[model samples]
Target: MRVYDVEGFPNPARVRIALAEKGAVDDVQFVSVDVMNGEHRSAEYVSKNPDASVPLLELDDGTYLSQCTAITEYIDGTYSGASLCGQSPKERAIIHMMNRRAENGLLDAVGDYFHHATPGLGPTLETNQVADWGKLRKSKAIETMRYLDDTLKSRTYVAGDTFSMADITVFAGLAFADFAKIEIPAELTHLSAWRKKVAARPSINA
Candidate 1:
């Protein structure tokens, strides 16, 4: 399998981290996508992913997969070394729920704010359409962070005691926010500590 990746990007980093957690980093081929030069918008890339996003996975059988969440789940399900998703139905549901909360509540909001509020990049992003909504979205993201910080005060990871897919999603989302100049609030002590833990992992730098 081959992974089309981009450095300094959140989505690709998520997959890379998952691969690292599963100890499958060296198993797959890596191809860099030059987002700086608008390579993802080219005809060749468009053919692979009509949405023109990075972090696309190409299977040996010629099947292509997009979206970081879906790609990471595929990797975790296929690899047996470490179970990043979960082992039981209840665990799976909890992890999925937390992952969705992080993605929809924080990650998507951060992306919207970055694309609409920040200058440069996001040329095709609907700046006008999201201009008014950017502030609201950013606020929502902060609220989610506060909730996560509070909930995580007594837990080690997002989904409970184990580091699961929910942790991966939250880590990636927060990492993305870092590049956008968004800083975690000082009150979110639990989340701040969790961020350091995830960052210290070897896979995160991969």
Candidate 2:
């Protein structure tokens, strides 16, 4: 298998962390996508992934997969490790629910604010700037932080007792928030603490 991505990007980071968690990072080939140069948006790249997004997975059987969630799910299922996606029906549902919340609320929200309101990827890529909508999404991202803080007060991880893909999503979301200059409130102690704990994980620390 091969993974195409740009290092340090939030979405790519999620898939990389998932591979690390499964101890499968060494087993796969990682191809760097020149996102800064807009290589990901090129016509040839778009053919394989219509979304033209980084962190694309090309399976050995000649199947191409895009989207961080879908790529991570494939990696989780293919490798023998503690599952990132859940093992049971109910667990999968809960993990997916929380993962979506984290992705939509924090990660994607921060991304919208960065690309729309700010000079994200410079003028070359961020052609459609909507300051007002981006500002609104920035507020949404912060609101999600507070919600996550409250939720984390009771649960050890985002979805439940064990660390799952939902936890990875939240961690990357918070990292993206930092990069986008969206401050996670100091008053959200639970969130801050949980972030610190997650940061220390082998998958992240590595």
Candidate 3:
């Protein structure tokens, strides 16, 4: 399988962490896509991913998969290792719920703030920016940080006790926040501690 992604991007980081956690990082080939140069918008690349997003997975049989959650699902289901999604139906549902929450509430919000409020990649790719909307989303991201901090105060991980995809999603989100220069509020001590712990993971270091 060939995974088309850019290094240091949050979504691709999520996929890499998933692959590492599943022990399948060495099983797939990594292809770097120069998204900053508008390579993703090119007709050839758009033919594979209509959304023009990175972290696209192409199977050996020529099937293409986009979206981080879907790609992680394929990896977790196909790869033989410890499960990242969860083992039981309840755990799976909760993990999915928290994963989406982290994605929408934090990661996507931080991305919106970066692209709309601030000059994201560059003027070429970040066309039609709305500073006011981006500012609002930035506030939303900070608010979500508080929510997550509170959530983490009671549990060791995002969904429950185990280290699941929800933790990975939030970790990637915070990494994106850091790249965008969005500082985590000083009052979010739990979130800060959690960030430090997650950052030490070998998957994240990879």
Candidate 4:
């Protein structure tokens, strides 16, 4: 399999961590995408992924998969490791629910704020930005942080006990928030504590 992404970018980091957790990091070939140079927008790149997003997975037989959720699901299913999705129906529903919340409320919110409100990736890539929309999303991101902090006060991980894809999403979200200069409030001790534990994980630490 070939995974196309830019290292250290928030979304790409999610896939790398997932791959590491599955012990499949070395199994896949990584192709770098130069977003800053507009390589992702090139016709050659868009042919494989219309979304023009990074962290894309290409199966050996010529299948292309984009989006972190879909790519992570493929990795979790194909590789032998603790399930990142879930085993039972209930677990699946809960994990997926939490994952969506983390993506929309935190990750994407921070991304919107960065790209729209701030000078994200500079004027070349961040054209057509809406400051008001970005500001609104920034507020939503902060609200989600508070919610996650409260949620973590009880559970050990984002989606209950085991560290699942939801946890990866939230971890990447917080990392992006930091890069975007959106502060996670100091009062959110539970979130901070949870982040510390996740950071120490072998997958993330790698």
- TM-score top scorer: 4
Local distance difference test scores for all models: 0.85, 0.92, 0.93, 0.96
Q: For each of the candidates, give the backbone clash count.
A: 0, 0, 0, 0
The per-prediction CA RMSD against the true structure, in angstroms, equals: 1.7, 0.8, 0.9, 0.6
Which tens-of-lDDT digit does each residue in 13-128 have in candidate 1?
Answer: 88888998888989999999987778898999999998799899999999999988789889998888768888899998998899999998888888887777776375653436
Ranking by TM-score: 4, 2, 3, 1
Clashing pairs in 3: none
Error of 2 at 109 (Å): 0.1
Alpha carbon deviation, residue 193, candidate 2 (Å): 0.6
The residue-by-residue lDDT of candidate 4 on 18-115, one tens digit each, is 99999998999999999999999999999999999998999999999999999999999999979999999999999999999999999999999999
Supply the global lDDT for candidate 4.
0.96
lDDT tens readout by residue for model 2, 1-206: 89999888899899989999999989889899998899998999999999989889998998999998898898899899899999999999999999999999999999999999999889988887999989999999999999999999999999999999999999999899899999999899999999999999999955
Instruction: Give residue 154's error in model 2 in angstroms.
Output: 0.5
Candidate 2 weakest ten by summed lDDT: 197-206
The residue-by-residue lDDT of candidate 3 on 11-45, one tens digit each, is 99999999998888999999999998899999999
Q: On lDDT, who's better, 1 or 3?
A: 3
Ordered from best to worst lDDT, the candidate numbers read 4, 3, 2, 1
Off by over 4 Å in 4: none
TM-scores across all candidates? 0.93, 0.98, 0.97, 0.99
Winner on TM-score between 3 and 4 is 4
